[model samples]
Each structure stands twice: as C-alpha cells, then as structure tokens.
Target: MFMEEVELFAVSALHNTATSPRLKELKVQQENDEVISRVLQYVRSGWPTYLPSHEILLRPYFECRSRLSTIDDILVLDSRIVIPHAERLAVLDKIHSGHLGITKCRSRAAQSVWWPNMSQQIAEMVKKCESCRKESNVQQPLSFVLSFLVVLGKN
Candidate 1:
C-alpha cells in the first residue's frame, strides 16, 4: 500500500507537465488508490516512465552542512570520480573557459567528495591561469603614502 502510494505520487509528479485531457483527469483523480494502482500497473507493463526531476536528484549535492568545508570535499571527490584522463583534461579546459564560474566549479568539486585540499588546489590553479590573469580585473595595490597625500591635498 505504501509502495502504491509512492508510485502514484511519483507518477503524478512526473506527469504534472502533461497536457492531455485524459492525463489531466487522471491527475485530478490521482488521490484514489484504484487510479494509482492502474497507473502503476500500466507503468509496469511497458509504458515509458517520465524523467525524474533533476532538482530532486541534485538536491543532496547542494545540501551541505558547512558550505565551505563541503565544497572543498566535493572538489577532491570530483577529481576521483572523473576517471578518464581525457575527462579530467576536459574539465580543466572548461575551468579555463570563463563559462565555468568559480562558484560553479567549487560546487561541482564539492559534489565529487574530493579531498579537503580541493578548494586550495582550485585557487592555486586559478591563480596560475594566465588567461584569467590577463582577462580579469587587476586591483590597484593600496598605499598609505597615497592616502596621506590625498588627505593633504584636500586640506
């Protein structure tokens, strides 16, 4: 009975986007066990199942107890999970591209269960990236002498 309820909920959630009248009616009447049972049986027979929500699957990856620590761990884990040398290279390439923001990279790294050193490693890697250095903003170094001079001039 529990399984049946779960199946019904899953089906209803999956088909929430469906537009057909029959589907709409089924969705409306979805609270009933008989309707759920029929849907479950139909799904079990041969009909295609709806794609599960990406948000549902990805929820755990983003739910970190400590954002900073978890993000670091994820990066290290990512290094291990991305097995193929080529895949690693590809990921590096993406990192090099401006398309992959720092936060996104860190989040992905955290998801991978990478070591604690992952965030530091990523920082070092970014620091050494010539392209980022060239394209990114360079902050002017602050000087006390400049500040003093500006104050004197104002006076």
Candidate 2:
C-alpha cells in the first residue's frame, strides 16, 4: 500500500513536471492502467487475485518460478521485465517491428518479457499482423529451387 502510494505520487509528480506534451500524455495513460497497478499491489501483498479475463494468471498456471520476481515492490518477470497486461498489445507491436515472422517475434519476446500464456498470445498476435503477413517471405519448394538452378546453369 505504501509503495503503491509512493508510486502514484511519483507518477503524479512526473505528470506535472513533464516538459513535453507527448510525455505527459503517456504518463496519464500509465497512471490509468489497471494491470500495472494490480501487479504492483500483488507483488507487495504476496497474494494473487484473479479478475475477469485474468484468471489465467493465477498461481496454478505458472510453469516455473524462474521467470517471476519482484523489483522495487513491483512484479517483474523474465529478467526483471515489467509487462502490464494492458500494455501487452502495444509491446507486441514493438516486438513485431520489421514485420518479423512468428518464430522471430516469439524469440524476441521470450528473451526479455513474459506473462501468462505469453508465447501462445504472441503467436496469435503475429499471425494476425497484417504487415508481417504481407511481408513474409514465401517458401520455395526444393524441386522448384533445383529446377531454377538447372535452368540458370544452362543459361
């Protein structure tokens, strides 16, 4: 409770002191995010509560403790990464930058961050990304490649 209050105060100060409009706007959104606040509260209290659409994050769902930890009273996962559920889609957008394929996106997120069912979620998101689908390389069959090589050699 104390830590969350302090965080709120700091965020309030940050909003007031922000010099740029964009930064202040971003801070406002962060302050409003329920997922970030809930995680912080959970880490401080050491008790988990499942909310609507968040039942997957309950204790029994975790495969291992290696990826979970708390930093400065805020929940951290996968090497101290702070991933609020509300921000998952936004983060996914960044990780999928350059129109990465599913494997690349999965590997990228795996290295730095995690949440419940994170891998499955990332796969779905990558699959639905329009840019990635449009830009993905089409795989050529072995026969086609060999035939193309033979034709090139004859030419």
- RMSD, one per candidate, in order: 17.4, 9.2
lDDT tens digits by residue: candidate 1, 46-93 = 323343364343233233212312111111122232112223334444
On lDDT, the candidate that comes out on top is 2
**Candidate lDDT (C-alpha), each:** 0.39, 0.55
lDDT of 2 by residue, 13-59 (tens): 43654233433443344346665555445545555333445545544
> Among all windows of ten consecutive residues in candidate 1, which has the lowest summed lDDT?
68-77
How well does candidate 1 score on lDDT at residue 79?
25
Q: Over 4 Å off in model 2, which ranges?
A: 1-57, 60-63, 78-80, 135-137, 141-155
TM-score of 2: 0.53
Looking at candidate 2, the ten consecutive residues that score lowest on lDDT are: 1-10
* C-alpha lDDT (0 to 100) for residue 4 of candidate 2: 29
Q: CA lDDT of 67 in candidate 1?
A: 32
